[model samples]
Target: MRKIIFLLFLIPILGISQIELKGVLTTGNSGTDVWEYIDPNNGKIYAVVGGNGMSMVDVTDPANPVEVSHLTSVPGFDVKVWQNYVYCVTGGGGTAQIVDISDPANPVIAGSWPSSHNIHIDSNGYLYASSPGTTIYDLNPNPTSPTYLTDIGTEGHDVTIRGNRMIDAHGFAGTYIYDITDPSSPQFLTIITDPDITYHHQGDFSTDGNYLYICDELGNHPQADITVWDITDYGNPTKVDETADPSATPHNLYVIGDYAFTSYYTAGFRVFDISDPSTLVLADEYDTSSATGEGFAGAFGVYPSPTTGNIYINDGSGLYIFGFDGLLG
Candidate 1:
């Protein structure tokens, strides 16, 4: 009887330890960053991949992704979607362009901007371009043709929108927060920095908007690559927790509910349990690369679809689709 009880206990523990994102499908052969677009008219889903150029892939079936369109003119290093349009920035600091995906089968360049490294669009349709700094644009009346708004002087690597606040990951300088409640007039909040910070690469806010997670691109090998900050006091942020892996370098991290998913360069896709902001635990991981080390050679981006619970990872080789049923709770 005691042996039976012990076996049952060990079974549950082993199940939890083995829990991870199961690979659902794999398609394509090259991509940099990946973002999803859900058509409001037809309710079909699509994946915008960034790499050699912009590639529009129909992901409605999730398991079988088909390349619907490709725009080779616009260099796609980073990508984002807003409504019916898709925004992409060229690799190695080229330029930003808006692509009309109203018809996913025939995507066309709608507009273009000056040299930008990354781009983002908020819920209110404000476009934030990281052209060495943060350049704001209004996409209200015309998303295809954005109107220049203003510039927030900071060496921005990436910008994220949380409610009415705009957070800029300013590489070596750290993170900057601004009140974008007024799209044109942004009010400076405060800068969050720590002595250990090497490069503030990308960031995302908690679902409840209480904590901020920053991924340091250069911090590697047993260093605090992913830092969690308490942003309840917007003006004065506090470092609450941090985590890292010795084998991989941190790139981008996205917080969805209680879990934090990251695109670890060589380590592939990593998931952390952030139920407690003071202490983060690595819950699961999926290696998307055969090579592993503290270098940039693997996964470049990880996007979790809130609508379908499908995890999308773009690596040096191609795009991977995974599904995690843990989000059902």
Candidate 2:
């Protein structure tokens, strides 16, 4: 069996300040899958270990992150945090584990839901989970005990919730929209399926909810590109722009203000300026050639800390925190 390794090297530019690497958190286990989330209220970082279960770390001190707690309830493959709670979905498990991290150092398992792979939460306190199907849970009644509202089966790969609308990246099923004003009974609004496109992996919406950035994971195909869609009119979505990079297959994306951060498999992390939704321009890119793996090695996720002015990238190796100075500006 071959081993995977991440070689860290810094390149300095005369006029441009390089993004500083704050810390690297590794489990010392080979082939460990890690996903991280930062609490908006506090600059604390939390990560879930895919291969060896989940681990929570207090990254308030970026230089030295302390491992606060670890839960082996299920091998967490994906994680999403909203408010003081962290929701994680396991790889082969049929249930999703919900943890109450109000006390950051001491996290307790609150509840569990069946059949979940990916999840997203809205400002209104609704938990949207995705597996082969999509399910919605109400988190306002009780933070610890979630109320199962409705299960909207739609072959969802990933879900993003904004206001009353929930966008579903339905793998080969394309992107579907649902109106969940009434949490218990969601209405299927529309389905946007373009045959010219390949697999729609993961995406995020603009803060104003005017546009959406969709990433297609099927790079071998010509249709693989980061597509920008105008969703001002939820009933009718229009493709604004589509851009592709020759070196990578975009798996997931993060949109903050006018900048969009993309995690590209094999090609590394690429940054694009989306000041104009219809026309996106490449601003900067960092190649992690050393982070390559056999299957899904490259870059899996990117989390930009709004408070610390730092960006964290997760490859197969571990969670790496980089200070984005020149990259964002």
Candidate 3:
């Protein structure tokens, strides 16, 4: 009888141990807009300031996330990190701020450039800024002093480079692909546009590099959907499949091993199994509904903890971290 009781206790304990939740940091009464969050090479936590400026947090212990320090720049939208530096893009100011975060606790502004909202860093240490268009900067020899290369903003919003191609999520314009083999002169290759789409918000290439998951901020009807495209042929992209739930208004998406985590506006965080890209299916969903409205209360950004299996979600109120158990299985 005692053995049976011991087994029961062990089972529950093991199950709970399989999953764990950690609350990293919380932003207080500042009413500041926390837009983009990135985990730098030094294993520190950094986030872009939207409403006010930029802030840094130490999430070494995700459970007790504490704000280390912050630098006030004109309000910015997104942040990208390469090596020991943090690159932030201002929304309306039209410039990118370079901060040396070699020390996570105290970040110092290294330099600035005429850029906007989103910034991308390539493997070669080149920084690409997206705003009025796509601008490339050479941040190789010295990060603090980046030499402006050229701006390729014929059309696009957020720009990212994979292998030899530069992809742009051109808002209502659609997705554009360019060849950046010659960094100095980027040759426009092709433009992939979906007639039924409105806004192409954010996306990333799959681990396999064969497909691209594009998030349409504007839902099909009044809400957006997750549109998957086959970029096997970078020059001529093809649409594979699209999934639209009644509560689909995906703002940003991140692709993990076999799952795609979507940060939807009012729907919160929705998870889908993309093991089969053509037939992507919904696996599970967590709703962070707001008391303000149906789709307003949930999550703004979802960051899957690198060290821990838990997932951190940022909403209008604060940050919520949850362990992956039934959700992952």
User: Please, what is the whole-model Cα lDDT of each candidate in the order they appear?
Assistant: 0.80, 0.68, 0.65
**What is candidate 3's lDDT per residue for 144-252, written digit by digit as tens?**
7888888876556777687887778888788777889987798987777887777776677776778888877765554437778888886678887887757446666
Q: How many backbone clashes does candidate 1 have?
A: 0
lDDT order of candidates, top first: 1, 2, 3
- The residue ranges of model 1 lying beyond 4 angstroms of the native Cα positions read 1-29
Task: Give the TM-score comparing model 2 with the true structure, all chains together.
Answer: 0.80
Residue 75, model 3: Cα distance from true site in angstroms: 3.3
Total colliding residue pairs, candidate 3: 9
For residue 211, model 1's alpha carbon misses the true position, in angstroms, by 1.9
Clashing pairs in 1: none
Worst 10 residues of 2 by lDDT: 1-10
Summing lDDT over every window of 10 consecutive residues in candidate 3, give the lowest-scoring window.
28-37
Candidate 2, 166-246: lDDT as tens digits = 778888888877777887887887777777677777787776778877877774545647788888887788988888756
Q: Relative to the unseen true structure, what is the C-alpha lDDT of residue 235 in candidate 1, on a scale of 0 to 100?
A: 67
Clashes of each: 0, 1, 9
Question: What would the TM-scores of all predictions be?
Answer: 0.90, 0.80, 0.79
